[model samples]
Target: MTDSAASPIDRPSFGIALILVGMLAISINDMLIKQLSGGYPLHQMVFTRSAIGIAFGLVIVQFEGGWQILKTRRPGLHAFRGLLVVIANMSYFAALAVLPLADATALFFAAPLFITLMSIPVLKEKVGPFRLGAVLVGFIGVVIMQRPWASPEDLGVSRLVLVLPVVSAITYAGMQIMTRKLGMSSKPSALAVYIQTMFLLVAGLFWIFAGDGRFAEGTDNESLIFLLRAWVWPEGVDLWLFIGLGFNSAAVAYCLSAAYRSADAAIIAPFEYTGLLLAVFWGWAIWGEIPGLEVKIGIVLIMGSGLFVFLRERQRNRPLASDPPRGTGATRR
Candidate 1:
């Protein structure tokens, strides 16, 4: 499929609204996952959530264009994209088990910066020096949040665990770039089904290997425990929360895929910062996790740099572009 065969009209405003909604849903999903981290293993939660998500995604498929829309000439790309999402989710959620919601979210917001940098090499787009500098400032924010100079006890998190969200950000950047590529030829609902299915497959593999919790024994690492812990049957409110995750996952996948597919990524990417605000609010209200002065400064720098990049891209009228795939259409802005 070609760009002309996909969406001919780019609706950036609509994309922004969708991304805001997606970010909101994502924040709620993170809170639920964190709340359940103590009692449930990550794979089990992923399994339950994905199973439910697949059911919802299939329903979306019917509304989209039926099961036919799910057929693609790019199965390999979809598979690769799914793997990237699974990696991104596992790493970020693992960090959530050990870090404050605000802190983990702040670190993960580095995805926009990674997206900007990756655009140059991966998409063959040109980035100006000013935008490059903004990327640098964003890294400084990540460093301040990490606080390498502080001891583990002083920081209240092991430095080793700090790497997880960064890993998540990098893989997520890669995944979103693929989303842009795949979005040119696929429906958002179809893209979402691929992701949910991947999550289910990975969760099943984890169940087969580590669901017994044998590997988690004698380990005090909270992040590892979250990954390797035995699966317990969820009861009462916990079951409802798991069900909620399914709805959240389906919403997030569709909204984000549609948002990126509909506009220049630079145009809508900054809207994702909304998640940070939601995370901070949820952290304080639910877990009593408050951002320190340094964390506040770091967040400011990160968000500031990202907004600057967005403004610069808009000012230059230089949205990232991919090589045209055979057929001609309106050039993406």
Candidate 2:
């Protein structure tokens, strides 16, 4: 008999290994982005990340033999996925500008809640009371984090901070749904290639046009300075970090995919909240920023809701409390 290692199927050990390593890389990537955000233009970081990601995807495609492994028959659906990339990155990066990585990620963790609701309407999937309750609790967590209804002064809400991630979360949830639907027939590598290529194309065009417009329309001397030079060029070390960012992003995709192959997604899902922990630590270490109690409570509530959903989902997938699920759901990595 052929060795199990030589089989086409990935072993349980293989997938879990991929997941742990991937999460570590993703954590490092998030920390890098948080550090890089302050001095560099958020859009510039967006530009490089998408660009480098495309380059990496292209390498993957070529190795798998040209566009055959990369192209999907569904152009429109692929484009929609591409748009989600634009929206989610813009929103998350915008949030990174002011919010600590931990705080912002805590808010973004609500995607599963959104996805659970979205599945009902879009995919016509049925959700039980448990999941619904989880969603409600997640919303309460969101309200605490955002304080969206409060007066601007009371909340310190700003243009980019509050609006960006709300939309980013919705788009990210859409992206997940698209991946699931596409997974029915489409190749994951193809989907990754499409997302990367289309995202870079669109974001590059945005920088070419929108950025130039903003520069031309920039009113103050400070704004003009941003337009003229300072924002374009961060230090050399920061530029190299963008390559690490690309690898980190790729690691997240690969890790989550591998992890899911081994165990139940719901069971693994709660681990995603660990990113909040990493983000918090990074925030303090890099910026000396301490979140207020409100932020801490928000993280706890959000993380709690996610953990509940994950456990509930795992129970459903495995159909037994004693039985472990067969897929993992390690988020962001």
Candidate 3:
């Protein structure tokens, strides 16, 4: 059997460590993006960050096994995965421009639940009644956080704006599914390069279409403004922040890929929750944002249900969260 085909049981501890590091990097990256959202367009930030990330990712690719390792037979799937990631990043960051950081992060955590549901159709995985119920409970948590019955004034933002993270989560789950399929043939660094390249291309297109800020005129909607605002040449500290985002993106992509590649997703997936705590910290420390009672309750339910789903998958010995294709050798390069 190839190294990649070897059982994940061999390096589970290392996988957990990698996931924790990835979550920390992600939390920092999110906080930085949110901080800059008021002054920068989402696509501009994505462009800057992706450009730097591609540079770093190329270096990683060289260390893994030179430029040839970047080649893949599944170009279409890679492109689709890249598109999914772009959508996920755009939706989530646009929400960050207006919503509280912790709230956005919590809502996006529903991706695990979405993955469980999507697996039934996408991966042809059978989820038993218990996991199905967990999925339902998780959605309930989502509804509670949304509080659709409340007015926009009371909730502090439009209900429509709140949906962005959920949209991001769904697309993110789809991206993970694609990653599982692609993992068999691609190295994590190569995958990161593909994603960064996509970000660069899409961001460039956004610049061509809307970077002039003409579309942002007369819009009071904060999210729309974040999306349509004109790109300004970042100066001084803002320039440094944008540069930092590139490093963070490179770290996040590679660490997460390596984490999942190293072990069973079930064993390491729960560690991904570390981001929630980091989100809470960053939110409070930087913006004085705290989760209200309703949000706290929603977070509890969503987290509980998501964890239960992972546990159930583990017990059943099914790989719903991320079942990489079988019989492929490790493409560590």
My TM-score estimates for the predictions, one after another, are: 0.92, 0.81, 0.93
Locate the minimum summed-lDDT window of 10 residues in model 2.
1-10
Note each model's CA RMSD in angstroms: 3.9, 5.5, 3.3
Candidate number that wins on lDDT, 1 or 3: 3
Among all candidates shown, the one with the greatest lDDT: 3
* Residue range 1-333, candidate 1, lDDT tens digits: 211256454798988898899989999999999999999999999999889888998998899778888777777876787898799999999999999999999998888788778877777777778888999999999999889889877987778789999999989777766655544456777778888888999999999999999999999999999999999999999999999998988888888767866776657766878999999999999999899987898899999998888778777776543222211111100
Off by over 4 Å in 1: 1-4, 178-184, 321-333
Q: Write the per-residue lDDT of candidate 3 for residues 209-288, one digit (tens) a residue.
A: 99999999998999999998999999999999999999988988888777776777778788888898899999999999
Q: Which stretches of candidate 3 lie over 4 Å from their true place?
A: 1-9, 181-184, 324-333
262 Cα displacement, candidate 2 (Å): 5.1
lDDT of 2 by residue, 1-333 (tens): 110111133355655566567656666876776677545655566567666766665666566446665444567766776777667866776676666777777888777778878877776677789878978988888888787667867766564476566677888887777556444233334445556666567656656665544553444322222222234655588768987777666656556644655554544455556667877887888778788877888788878877787687666663312111232121322
Arrange candidates by lDDT, highest first: which order? 3, 1, 2
- Candidates' C-alpha lDDT: 0.81, 0.61, 0.82
List candidate 2 segments past 4 Å from native.
Answer: 1-13, 62-67, 148-151, 182-188, 213-231, 261-264, 318-333
Question: How much is 229 displaced in model 1, in angstroms?
Answer: 0.4
